[model samples]
Target: MNSKKVRILVAKPGLDGHDRGARVVARALRDAGFEVIYTGLHQTPEQIAETALQEDVDAVGLSILSGAHMTLVPRVKKLLRDNGMGDVLMVVGGIIPEDDGRELINNGHADQVFTPGEPLDNITDYIGSKIRS
Candidate 1:
């Protein structure tokens, strides 16, 4: 039993002001014993990657509802990799179409994309299964 908590940085990038879902998921990850850092709102890709690097997090969870997924997600992913945190698991959630989500995964930008109505437990389980390898 390592006893180390998995550190997760949950960010609401772009001009999206709606963060209720992000907050709920942050709380859920915390409840699941992961250390969660949530950047409030309107964060730039540079800001998100900088925060993740500074926090030394194991993963990053992006909550995007702003219809700017294609533009924002990839930039953030590139910055994360550029900052030498490429191995950090990146997951996205919120109003993204299935095709778009798959494209993000296929393009190697995202590790996972979660949509609305997804069980919170599934997110927790997925991260738990991937973290310590």
Candidate 2:
């Protein structure tokens, strides 16, 4: 078995105060053998991108329930790209509408968007596959 472990940063961006889902997912990712970093709450796009760069994380998983994903998600993506961290995998979760999720993917804001109630394993598997590929 490969001994390498993936590092992921799980952050709650914008004014979203509901972090229950983010906390659950972060724990689940850690249990799945990922080195997970949970960035409390109310993080800005620049802060998230900066953390991802500084931590040298393999991926960034954002948990946003504020319905401002349309703005925040893309901004983070842009900042990462601008900071030359464009290679990192970007994934988002929490209370997102299907159309918005599709738009995010189509516009390159995120590689995947997980909705509420999706199995945690699905997220782990997706990140694993994307990183290994």
Candidate 3:
């Protein structure tokens, strides 16, 4: 059995100063036995992608509530792909609209779009299933 912990980078991108949810999620993920890197507030997409590469994480969780997901998710996704990290699991959580979430997934911008009220187990279980560590 592989004992390597699933590494995840939790990033807060853009000028959205609200990070309570991101922190909460990060903590829960840590408790769930994943190695999580929390990049504190106000991060650019470039920085996020760079960190993802540097950390060699298995997944990235983008927590955005600034209403800039439409612009940010794509930019980050592009950067990840550009850097040859395209297969890295990409997940976004925030106040995204239902249609927008579907569009993000449909458009291949994100592997999953999670909105408010999703149980922590859902996130943890989904990641555990998708990624074998």
Candidate 4:
């Protein structure tokens, strides 16, 4: 086993019932050697944050496809900030509009945004780079 594990929390927030993307990402991350904790479907920002804290993850990756990225990302960011875990890197993926991606980064809600069909290597590389630095 790798001695250094980059812990990541993959969460599905809001009413998005589609989880195939999230699950695939989780598996990819795991295969890439990161310890992944997936918080199934229909999770709230609060629940995601709490799980991140409990899991002591280095980053939180939220998969949102319900067009609720604006509302959900900020909520998760606020929750992490309130809990003094704001330093935990937040990355989002899935059906996020280009403008919304910029908004998320500007608002400090996400460090990176991966759209549909982005390679798994890119996601894993992003996580590795963030965690390593």
Candidate 5:
């Protein structure tokens, strides 16, 4: 096992029932040697933040495809910060537009945003780089 195992919480937030992408990302992260905890589906920001706190994860990765990224990401970030877990890196992936992605990052909601079809290695490398630093 890798000496530096980054604990990550991969969550599917909102009514987005399409979880194939989220599941694939979780598997890729696991294969990359990070310990991944996946929150099944239909999770709210509160639930995700609470899970991140309880799991002591180094990062929280949310997969949002319902065009609710704007509302959801900031809420998640705020909740985490309020719960004293502000250091936990937050990331979002899925059908997010470039403008919205930038907004989320600028608002300090997410560290990065991965759109659909981005390689798995990209996600793994990003997580590794963030956690290892």
Candidate 6:
């Protein structure tokens, strides 16, 4: 077992002033034994990408409940890709429609899309498996 913990960046983008979900997930990730760096709320794509790069994180968990996943997730993915961090795992959790979630994954913008009521263990396990491989 590689005892090294996975590093994660949990970000809330757009004008979503509500971050209770983001905070919950960040705490969950930390409890799951992953090193988490929260980017706070209303962060730009550039800022998220830069922080991920600077922190050398292995994954990014985007929490967007404002229904801006289509616009924000892709932009963050693009920024990370352009900055040579495309290999980093990108997962989105929010109030996104199933169709949009499928689209985001189909387009390779988000590795996975999590919705409300999803167990934190699912996210943590998925991230652990992905980063471990």
Best model number under lDDT: 1
The C-alpha stretches of model 3 lying farther than 4 A from their native spots are none
Please provide TM-scores, in order, for all candidate models, with all chains considered together. 0.97, 0.95, 0.96, 0.96, 0.96, 0.96
Error of 4 at 71 (Å): 0.3
Worst 10 residues of 1 by lDDT: 1-10
Query: What TM-score should be assigned to candidate 2?
Result: 0.95
Clash count per candidate: 0, 0, 0, 0, 0, 0
- CA lDDT, every model vs. true structure: 0.95, 0.92, 0.94, 0.92, 0.92, 0.92
Per-residue error at 120 for model 3, in Å? 0.7
Worst 10 residues of 4 by lDDT: 1-10
Q: If both were scored by TM-score, which would come out higher, candidate 1 or candidate 4?
A: 1
* TM-score, cand. 5: 0.96
RMSD of each: 1.0, 1.4, 1.2, 1.8, 1.7, 1.2
Error of 3 at 33 (Å): 0.4
lDDT of 4 by residue, 1-133 (tens): 2466889999999999989999999999999988999999999888998998999889999999989889999999999989899999999999988998998998788999999889999999999988897
List ranges where model 2 is wrong by over 4 Å.
1-4
Q: Report the candidate with higher lDDT, 3 versus 5.
A: 3
Candidate 5 vs. truth: CA RMSD? 1.7
Off by over 4 Å in 4: 1-4
Query: What's model 6's TM-score?
Result: 0.96
Worst 10 residues of 2 by lDDT: 1-10
- Residues 60-107 of candidate 2 have per-residue lDDT tens digits of 999988899999999999999998988889999989999999999998
Check candidate 1 and list the clashing pairs.
none
- The 10-residue segment of model 3 with minimum total lDDT is 124-133
lDDT (Cα, tens digit) per residue for candidate 1, span 4-37: 7889999999999989889999999999989999
